[model samples]
Target: MLLVSLILLGAIGTRLAVLQLWQGHIYRDKAENNRIRIVPKPPVRGNIFDRKGRVLASTRLTHAAYLWPIVVKQPDWPKNLKYLSQLLSIPEESIQSRIEQAGYNSPTLIRIARSLNPAQITALEEFKTELNGLEVDIETVRDYPNKAMGAHVLGYTGELNAEELKKRQAEGYRLGDIVGKMGVEKAYEQQLRGEWGGIQLEVDGAGKVMKVLGQKVGQPGKDVTLTLDLDAQRAAEAALGDRKGAIVAINPQTGGVLAMVSNPSFDPNVFSSQITPKIWKQVQSKGNPFVNRALRGFPPASTFKLVTATAGMESGKYPPNTILNTFAYLNVGGTAFGEWNRAGFGPMGYVRALAWSSNTFHGQIGRGVGGPTLIKWARLYGFGKATGIELDEEAPGLIADDAWKRKNYNWEWTDGDTVNMSIGQGFTQASPLQVAVMFAVPANGGYRVKPHFFDNNQDTNKWRTSLHLKPTTIKTLREGLRAVVAEGTGKALNVPNLPPVGGKSGTAEAPPGESHTWFGGFAPFDNPTIVVVAFGEHTGGGGGSTAGPMVKQVMEAYFKNNKR
Candidate 1:
């Protein structure tokens, strides 16, 4: 009997030793995890300023209510959600949607409500004991002071998506972090996002804080100053009105973007807060309110004539005084190319032809220089490539060559295509930003200035290329452009009150009843400072009637405020 009792006692001792010595750490770690919580403190995002020190974007501190899913059971969610819905004055379905969007079933804390008013906050605090696993968290909300005024340029921030988080996790971005989704905000995200810090807290089994263990404050992001003129931006947007169009203004002296406007702008503030599915669909529709039209491609219309004129003169096919016979229509192959005015400008020199914007005259020039020469001149003037602007949304406009045509369309280039391109009506396309650069080249000493938004001590003089263009040719083009505003298609823009402005007008055919209008030029013809380009989509009217006055209004306001 004594031997049997000793055997049972030894067996019991062995079992206790196995659990205490071998598996002790595993259980201890589980208990520690239950009692300790690491709460992350999101750092404040940086502020954005315009060149004149106007605040464009900044951060505002606000309170948000979060739910600890581990502490709140699945069965109790309905009751808890109902209580939260009443306290926050939000629908219970909305709270559930928020929880689902946040993946509340996962280990991560879910933010169920944000932007709490004082009344909501007081109620949440007073009813804290009644709410299960509910905690208030301080959140940094992105704020755009000017609202939708510069939405494209300022951009907006939103919570990171799964794809973004996967890509940025190595860069220290958390799942719930708000990130720049577009515009300068996205481009300078690294500079604008702050480092996240955290605090270790001792918590009870119910997830209530018992003691503070340790904490580290987060670092704020650095500020970014842009070379945008607020007043000029407002003026440009006002001139554009509610039409589907864009306006780009550049400092002729430095290629610095003064003002850029894309109409039908959505409020960045809408993106800063939680975006509703309906609002998201509305902004992401065919209208594409998020796209920066200044950097988007469009049929350039007659503005591309500037490229044709440059090519013609440089190829030695058409001199400054070279006279070309122009009629109502010119037949090339099976296609009949016609001028805007059926009566035509008759036979005229290059200067007069440019002023009249005679399609027959440019078609003849296109035939003389052919497609190759036009493409070369177009590249020289910064086409078929991004202008190397600070923004990433810029489109490298199509300047299709023979090789490109064969590869993309499986067709060879033809004289008909050349003629149509010369008039800026065929496959040729460009952005308003490119148009501004094309005209600014002549306005600013015939050099291609790299368009920029930030202040760089870049030697613009060194970046200037004559594009193998002769001084005489530039002078002729400049004089002809002046004549355009004085007596030709752009004559409607000859405002008596404002200083003399020289520009080229263009009307490119769109669909059956639509035309894209374009006007590009510099002001005060004698001493130009600002280069402006205005483009209207499906305007029906030509450049002189549609985009011309918009440019005039912007230029007039700029000159009035600047006063060189």
Candidate 2:
């Protein structure tokens, strides 16, 4: 029994010695790993520049204050909250609420204050030693030098909150990051957001960063240059002059968007970094500054007459010289449709009626062209389809047809519908961008060019297409459009010493006693350089009085500046 006891005692001693001496380092390393450490790194957002290399959107370093919840140890929570609130210039209740929400056990960093100025930084520094949980770090925030000018196009960013973080995690985004919320920023987010960089640091038991172990430097995102002319954009905005409307201008030859203006724009800087709930609520409640009206759909008004003319000409239903008698009013299905002026060209040809914008003439042509032909020509002109521009939330303008009417309204086609469609009214709707494309088609000699804002290093030649039209048809339409500007209703927009210009005007009635006025035209009629479309909401009268003058001024500025 003594020998067996001795052998067991020796084995137990050997096992204890092995555990203490041989595996001590391994267990110590495991214990150290259990104290979790996470270092968040942010990716550099892309830069936005104009076609001439002017900076439109960028990022700058700013100071952000954070609180480490686990390190905070206070006997009186209220006292600690008061101290933080006074230092951060935040409400005491808000500070206390955030602390309670962060919980006590976790070591996650919660943002208490952000974008601190120099004086605020000094104030925060004074409390560093006394505030156990407080931490100040440097981070980059979006900066727009030209405030509120291109708000609808450039968009803005905001810090990721808890719900946003969950979405980011699912989409492979790291925590505590800013993302594009609208405009080009949101549409090309993947290309604009580069890879993130990370750093490893050794921390002491006190939770202080003791030493930097390793780091991978972040790469700056690619610079994107847009086709927008800042000066022209500003001019367009100025011309809008306190009206609710939108304008889209494009280079007819290349399909490059020159200027896009939507009035009542909000400053993008408001959304950069962290947008407080109060500010966000205010923005949402007041007049919808977030809406991009250029992409929003509206009745094309008389501007749609261009499409009717194209359809009629293309379908062999009517020539430019085809004659129709225009009475002051015409009756279709007991509904009297009349001209805006309440006077008609007693007996006129197609060209004369188009230049005069005779409602009765086009209405008669629409009947001759029929519904299918109208829809075909409208689709061919790029209506009823998204322009495929690199912007968020584009609306495809509606083009009602027999099938569409049957499916949506559960009704058959009527002569009244055809007449209304011919006049660019009824259920047909389009965006300013779509109208710009339609104007560009005739200006470019019948080519259907896809509108684009970014070049992105692609060869310009690759994006060009030629839409062949009969030379006779092109000539007839060109003369008719010029006559409209020369001696007809569009005479108000005629400018002296500039190249010959051609255009069409339209007035579309909105619901509940509102009106949408529109004008679409191209400049230097011989070799068109630019195509412009302008619209004004609730503006009384035709496009000539409301939208034409605006288009004229913009064209004048563009021609004088470009001087080609």
Candidate 3:
């Protein structure tokens, strides 16, 4: 009996030792984990500045109203919800539903309102003691000082939804965090979004933050200084007027984009905050205001004649003085094409034909240069490829070849297609940005520059390192382009302040009776300073008539500001 009793005592002691010592740390850890909370602390985003140091985009502190459902007393919930809803301009039912959905066990923050003005915040603070559920917190929100100016370039920020959060979680983004949605904001998200920091606070049983245990301050994002001259941008947009089109201006020496204007732009400030369903529907329902026409593909029209000129000259098929007879119309492969002026120059040299933008001249040149040479020169000028700008949704235009036609449409190439392409017509399209770069090459002595918006300060080196043309070819092309603007179709819109501006004008026939007018040019023909391209949709006239004046006006403003 004694031995059995002793054994029983030993077993009890072992069990007690296991519970008191062996498993103590595990239970303590589980308890601590159950009570301890980890909340995300958002880092301060970087500031965006124009070249002149003007604040384009910044962040500011704003008051937000939230409900801590777990801490609210049952009897006070209704009164508190009503008071907060009325104060925040929100419906009382919404506040109640949010709280109920959050449940009592989970200490979730239910946001009632954001961007509360100082007066509203003051009024709410007075009742903080009485309303357990109501709380005021400071949060950073995006601010745009210039309203709608440079909206597309500056972009906007908004709260990350489920999908965005999931995609960017590896990049340090969290649910309910604000992220750059488009434009520069989206492109430089990593550089613009700095490291996030947080404060570790000891909380009471009621979820009220007590004395701060530890704090980690957030680092501000790096400041981004752009090369955009707001003055030039404003002038370009203004000159564009109510026309539905785009204007792109670049520095020929550096490839720095000075102005990029797409008319009918939206105020990015509207998107920075909470966008209403009504406003969203209106923006979406409207006719393509969101489409950035500067980056979109359109028919090159007569502006593409420069490519034909290049092919003809390089292939030794035509000299600068080569003469071609121009009639009112010409038939190739039984399809007739005519010049803008019903009566063409009876007999004109190659230079005069280009000066007059004679369609007959180009048609013949196309047939003479043939398809292979035309395609080669077109590819050399960077057509049928993306311009490699930092923006999203860029389209590589169609460069049609016999093989392409056979594979895609199962048709053979003909003189009609060749003639059409030579005049910048059927199966050929280019973005305004592309045309501007194309013009810049010959204007700047044959260095084909990749146009870019962000100013890297190293743009000159970048351009020099990546230039894609022979010096002789660039020089020859420059003279032809110079003549086009000096005495050719582009002369009428030349600005006196700009020295020897060279350009080409094109009137692309749109679908059934409409036309898209285009003007692409570069200034100081001998030593180029700037290159500009403008396009107007459904403009009844040629590039010289419709798009030329706009480009001239923008260039005039730009030069006026610089005053070299």
Selected candidate, larger TM-score, 1 vs 2: 1
What's the TM-score of every candidate structure? 0.90, 0.88, 0.86
Off by over 4 Å in 3: 1-40, 67-113, 117-134, 459-461, 464-476
Using lDDT as the measure, which candidate wins?
1
lDDT of 3 by residue, 220-264 (tens): 788888878877888888888888888989877777778888867
**lDDT scores of the candidates, listed in order:** 0.83, 0.79, 0.77
lDDT of 2 by residue, 1-564 (tens): 999999999999888888778988876654453243444456778898877778889988898887766556667566768876766667887666666665654455666677887877887778777765677778777889988888888888776566776667867775456788888787777777777776666666566687776787876677788988877777788777778888888988788888888876788887664456677777776477777788888888777777777777777878666777888888888888897669877888756776888898888778788888888888888889898888857899898888899999899989899889889899998999999988887788888777888866576555566556667677777887888899887887787856788998888889786688988889899899899889887776778878988888788888877887
Model 1, TM vs. native: 0.90
Cα-based lDDT at residue 161, candidate 2: 62
In model 2, state the lDDT of residue 356: 87
Worst-scoring 10-residue span by lDDT in model 1: 101-110
